[model samples]
Target: MGDFAEAVRERVRRAREAVAAAHEAGDVYAVAEAREELDDALRMARDLGVDPGAGPEDEHEDPR
Candidate 1:
């Protein structure tokens, strides 16, 4: 993966973590906002033709 892809991947990872944190904290509004950010990151990755390796379809795949 190129630098752009790596950066986007990092963004997606951070966004995902944020969403999880918001959910854990029981912050409804924060969860919604974080979800939106994650959605945007996914869309951006798709548009850039970057395989984020972190999507619904990859949920069951081994991290390694």
Candidate 2:
């Protein structure tokens, strides 16, 4: 991947982590904000053809 796509992928990864952390902290506001950021990151990935389908959540998912 080029630099732009790689950067977007990193942003998406960070956004996912932020969302998980916000949920873990039990902060509704932070969770909402993180969700927004994640959404934005995903949108950017789609716009840039960065293949947003696979993410952290997929890491632990079963192949089946």
Best by lDDT: 1
Q: Which residue segments of model 1 deviate by more than 4 Å?
A: 55-64
Candidate 1 lDDT by residue in tens digits, 1-64: 6888999999999988887788788888988898899889989999989987755425843112
Count of residue pairs whose backbone atoms collide, per candidate? 0, 0
Enumerate residue pairs that collide in model 2: none
Report residue 4 deviation for candidate 2 (angstroms): 0.8
Candidate 1 — number of clashing residue pairs? 0
Cα deviation of 15, candidate 2, in Å: 0.2
**Model 1 weakest lDDT span, ten residues long:** 55-64
Q: Each prediction's Cα lDDT score?
A: 0.80, 0.79
**Tens-place lDDT digits, model 2, residues 1-64:** 6888888988998898888888778888988898899889999888877886686555763212
Worst 10 residues of 2 by lDDT: 55-64
lDDT of 2 at 46: 84
Q: What are the C-alpha RMSDs, in order, of all predicted structures?
A: 4.6, 4.7
| TM-score (C-alpha) between model 2 and the true structure | 0.80
TM-score of each: 0.82, 0.80
Score candidate 1 by lDDT.
Answer: 0.80
